[model samples]
Target: MAQPAARTGPGPRRAQDIFAATFALLTELGYDGLTVEGVAARSGVNKTTIYRWWPSKDALLGAALIDSRLFELTVPDTGTLRDDLHALLDQMRKLLTGEEAGAVVAAVLSAATHRAELAEVTRSFFLDRLGRELPLFERARRRGEIRAGLDPKTVIDLLAGALWVRVLLRGEAAPAGFVRETVDLVLRGVAA
Candidate 1:
């Protein structure tokens, strides 16, 4: 995992340390089993420092999600809309199928049911990541790479919905070649 960019100015390093440590713990122990005290021990930072930074465990986890590169995936432009979408989905498939990814997904979903605020934060995190891919589709539309009259948001949701169903409900690994088929279906439409 990539480290957060170095912070300049006063008191930034402490905050980064706390966030990094929190993310490490969350990835390891998960949301239900995580504790601030464990974060303090793992980070070598004091509990007072954590409390001073974040009010609650959820808040810390939220910030950690943002700070960590676990959600910092970049959508690549491969000159064609289908290729670009495939690249992005391939990255997501890797993430969803990884060892730590399952725990991370479960943690986010578990947080959503009991904690509205955390849910919102997690939603924002996903939206922010997905938002990065939208402009690629828009650019492709302008280039006539995608079919006209197709809504970018709808296309995005369509692809994401399929992947999420597999990840969240079925708990099955995203199969290889799934992204290619999805991109083909999206571009060509559902017509036989």
Candidate 2:
């Protein structure tokens, strides 16, 4: 007797459905309450299907974050460091303040603290984002837009840290014109 053909994995449509389900669950259940079974049920997919693509909830959530454009941190190249900084910072500010994103962001941040593996994944995600932006700083330095001795890592830490504390810890909306002010302050410290 001939054996059945091997099973192929999810295609693009199925992946989108899975991601949509993941986001919906994140918004409804929050991170702690979310599970693979829940996503499978919501997506009308099987648990094995999700498992084939993502090994764990953390992995699933990370992929959903990327796929849904929730982690959309594209570094801008506007020909000037100030302009680029404003663009990037404003993107971050909008992400943090957007109503649709608040629950998901809060869930992810809370999960990072409660789950060690998730925390590591979150750390890696942030490091990768920072790495992607390093070239922006490098370009600015090469063009004499910023000081020669500037460090990308330090700059990112200062900027990201301030935002993290303002939104997460203090639970305060970043003040009006916060993104512009942040860019100007950081530029003043680093401009050539």
Candidate 3:
């Protein structure tokens, strides 16, 4: 009999599908209701495969958040701090404005509130992902685009918070020029 092939993780498309299913289920069922079986059925991945890839629901959700569009944000280097911030915020705006995303975000937050493991995973996941943007801030500093004493985390919080309020809190997409104007206002305060 032939031996089984060495198994690696799901490919990008498979992973995306799994992650998307995870969020859709999360939106529908909330965190406690999400399970690897449901993920397998929804994503068309085997239940054993999902369990093999991620040991627990927390772990699976962690990976899903890492891979999903709503959480897996990338920082853009637009050669200028202004453009970079605008681009980043625009990406966030799109996510925040997504119909299912807001519900999923709220569900995640609600679930995180009740689950310590989930809260830690959520915290670390955001920190780890958001930390990637530090490089963009460092680049801005090198180029004398922002003040020497500027705090990247604070700036990010300010910008992201504005968008979150507009979308999640106010339940509205960002009005025209919101990203640009927000970036302009933030850069004015932090500009070199």
Give the better candidate number (2 or 3) by lDDT: 3
Q: Quote each prediction's TM-score.
A: 0.80, 0.86, 0.87
Model 1 clashing residue pairs (backbone): none
- Of 2 and 3, the candidate ahead on TM-score is 3
Q: What is candidate 1's TM-score against the reference? A: 0.80
Please report, in order, the local distance difference test score of every candidate based on alpha carbons. Answer: 0.74, 0.80, 0.84
- Error of model 1, residue 10, in angstroms: 9.2
Candidate 2 — worst ten consecutive residues by lDDT sum? Answer: 63-72
What tens digits encode model 2's per-residue C-alpha lDDT throughout 8-115? 657778877887788778888888778999999999999997998799998987777766665577799999888887788778877887776766778788878888
Which parts of model 2 have CA positions greater than 4 angstroms off? 1-13
Q: Which candidate ranks first by lDDT, i.e. highest? A: 3
User: Model 3 Cα RMSD, Å?
Assistant: 3.0
Q: What TM-score does candidate 2 get on C-alpha atoms?
A: 0.86
Deviating ranges (above 4 Å) for candidate 1: 1-20, 27-30, 147-149, 190-192
Error of 2 at 78 (Å): 0.8
Model 2: residue 19 alpha-carbon error in angstroms = 2.5
